[model samples]
Target: MTDSARPRRATLSDVAAAAGVSQATVSKALNGRDDVAAETREIVLAAVAELGYRPTTAPAASSRRTIAVTFDIPASPYILNVLQGVLVAATENRLDLLTRLPPDRAARGQRAVGRDWIAEQRASGAIGVVGLTLSHPDALLDAASEASLPFVMVDPVDATHKRLVSVASSNWAGARTAADYLIGLGHRRIAWIGGPEASDAARDRLYGYRAALDAAGLEIDPAHVVADQFDAAAGARHARAMLGMDLPPTAIMAADDEIAVGVLAAARELGVSVPRDLSVIGFDDTPQAPWTTPPLTTVHQHLDEMGRMAVHTVVAIADGRRPVSRHVELATSLTIRETTAPPPA
Candidate 1:
């Protein structure tokens, strides 16, 4: 065959044929769809690599793409990380991104602004919606399902209703990691400062803290578990209450970095020395964790990965790919810093 006549490019169809799969299967495997079996998907990927096939980047295809992302709060560092991953991936694919913030940041609530936003975007030909920490209304979830808007949630919803497509870090595991760290350091008189009553994360964190105590053959002190909102001020309030108790705890676990900082401040005000008179461990290792006075020992939530997964799931669904489940949970790790230590003698 003449060099000019030899095919210079392998197409998706060629890869599918080589892997003995459908064209759609090849697309799913290449696009990181979670629907395909791991082994079969790996085979398809290997075939793609062997065939040196690349997806087309024609303007016609590029112009057909747009995504709307709604976040629970624009001010949250965690949400900011999620947004970064979604925006970076979308930009790389030459997709248009429309970011929406909740109507009232002060209300500290998530409004399904996504539904109305989705309607307008759909009028302009948007393909899907990606939401981070989305506390969507039931009607909005129903609307997404009816409209087939390819909705992807960043994490699990507090209440159960179907139609939630999500990719999330394991809050339970993150909390467990924090508890394990405290246990390993010989902190037996531990307490937990949780978030609001309605938060899925707050519940998971509380469970983990209790699990660790149970494993150590310790009874959970009801008075030691203080649940509050997910803010520094709330943390301070809870910490103050805990500190004021006649028999205060030796260590406290906060559900987030902000709460941990509040605890630290409260400890100082009450003349309690961290890691000496008291120990504080937290979750979400926010950027502020290391900056805290004694630094903070906390759980490392993979927010960037969560964001990427949410975007990938939404975009894949938009392209007619079905994921394995409506819910996806990612893993989390622990970051041990200087804040926690053995209880005082």
Candidate 2:
């Protein structure tokens, strides 16, 4: 294909030729590697821009500096809160940050999408990865080890890998605190609503609730422990089902604010008044927590603090600090709102 008919792709050779430099020099300069003369590097980049060459889109590996942050799940209040912190830290460190979502299971393992995404960035000289999953990608951990790139995890991990830095909140402890607050309110026949059973957060929160109830010598009736997705509708359904039982729970502890809001809807629909008929508590005091019909009482996760900490941890690792020891766990508080009150007689 001629230049015009040649598919419009810009290659290292094309950039080198345009800048009257060697391909090796173009590669080094574009990749931000040392040894290329500063002036030569500038010329190659100028030519690259003049030709409208997008490094990331190139078939060959990138020859530009890039950084990436990824999550197993898509952007949610949880992920984005941390992502905003990652961006601030990455920018402060003068690194370009790219956020990618892992592909569905059909494309895992050999396709190991996370590693591929990071590798593509590596080919362009990306030197850091900020992972928001509670677990880190083993392949990604391996790749970073091989490349000596910085790998910062935003949450806890069961397995350890070199260059694995993490910043996390004490989900278990926070959940316990939340449960304790509800228990202190004299709520004995408390019901626990859980999220996806497989989620680390859900597991921890559930453990917290069980621990407190057990300490109180209370038997946890499995029927009262409902599992649902982290949404208001699911919470509503779970609450409705629980309420329809021969004997319903007095207070409900939802897995999240969304689920708690659903509980509110369920109460209204069932002609049960909150605080008088039912007491509700939610986790993750999202912005909407205060707007729920009765202003949901919830655990105030330090989302901003979490985000700021993740950014700090990732950036510190990128700057060559010993980051593995920096497992900072911010505390959460129970924000008393209108939704929760002493259970009625």
Candidate 3:
């Protein structure tokens, strides 16, 4: 599509002018500043909605040094939080940031992103890329290397590849911490619910769990380890299967919050009381974690920091600076909520 044919993005200034208020007033109203009058806030909001104004706190890009954050799927549930962090960094750095939701064929893998796509990015002044889950494709990397376009991956599916520059949480350490916490609670029979076995994060977390078990002289129960998608449905299915065992686990550590929520559902369905009879722990600590029936005990991954650092790394690469490290792994911590307690007598 031609530039002229594209819809013009409504700015804060546009909203301010339409609302008959100063730009700062519009900003305060949008940000919920207490000083803004309720009537003025409503006017600004109405103008914003009418004008289709989207906030981009960042300064405009001068048609040069634009950074593209590409995703595998447009509606991937986890991108919103990460995008916020990226935008914050983009704003601070005064860089133009845009998201590219590649078509399935263009996004499946690095090799899948065709030569035409690379040419298009180069033509559009996209000098750097921050990829969510898209890993190293030799061809795409080669094209990037030749074009000197810096590339960085956020939470890649496989982070072990030396060629890949990725930002990820300390999955192994977080998993180990969860396992140890369960052991500390006097739970002998602990089950694990993890995502697809192929994922590096999942694998690392699984290994960490096992490492903790080994350290505590507990045998890893094969029946308790289930590999499924990181969703409530998968959690429910796995939890049900585990709960059906004659000697079910007293505690279950799920790899993601969605799965943890699923475990809670299965527990409720099976008449298993959380924490009293069965303790549950999850990772990622996404927003939904705290709202589950009994709340969720989770390992928090600093996703926003990861997003912020991703922009910083990619921008640095674009600026012709060689980073001291190609990969960055942020720390993880445990958030104790309502779902975990000492095992039943």
The top-ranked prediction according to lDDT is 3
Deviation (Å) of 238 in candidate 1: 0.7
Ranking by TM-score: 3, 1, 2
How do the residues 87-149 of candidate 1 rate in per-residue lDDT, one tens digit apiece? 887876667887765344443233344344334444334576776765534455555565566
Query: Distance from true position, residue 198, model 1, in Å?
Result: 1.6
**How would you encode candidate 3's per-residue C-alpha lDDT over 107-184 as one tens digit per residue?**
535542544344445434565777776633445555455445677888876544457677889999999999999999
In candidate 1, where is summed lDDT lowest over 10 consecutive residues?
Answer: 106-115
| Top candidate by TM-score | 3
At residue 302, what lDDT does model 2 achieve?
74
lDDT of each: 0.75, 0.72, 0.79
Q: Give the residue spans of candidate 1 off by over 4 A.
A: 1-64, 102-117
- The residue pairs in collision within model 3 are none
Cα distance off (Å), candidate 3, residue 312: 0.3
Candidate 2 lDDT over residue span 1-345, tens digit each: 567676656666787899998888877775657787777766765676455444433224433345677776563566666677777766766667777664454444332354444444554555566677644366666655654566667664442554456666677777788778778888888998888775667778889888988888888888999776877889999999998889899899998888898899999999999988899999888888888888889888877666566666655665568654756667777798888777787
Sequence-dependent TM-score of model 1: 0.77
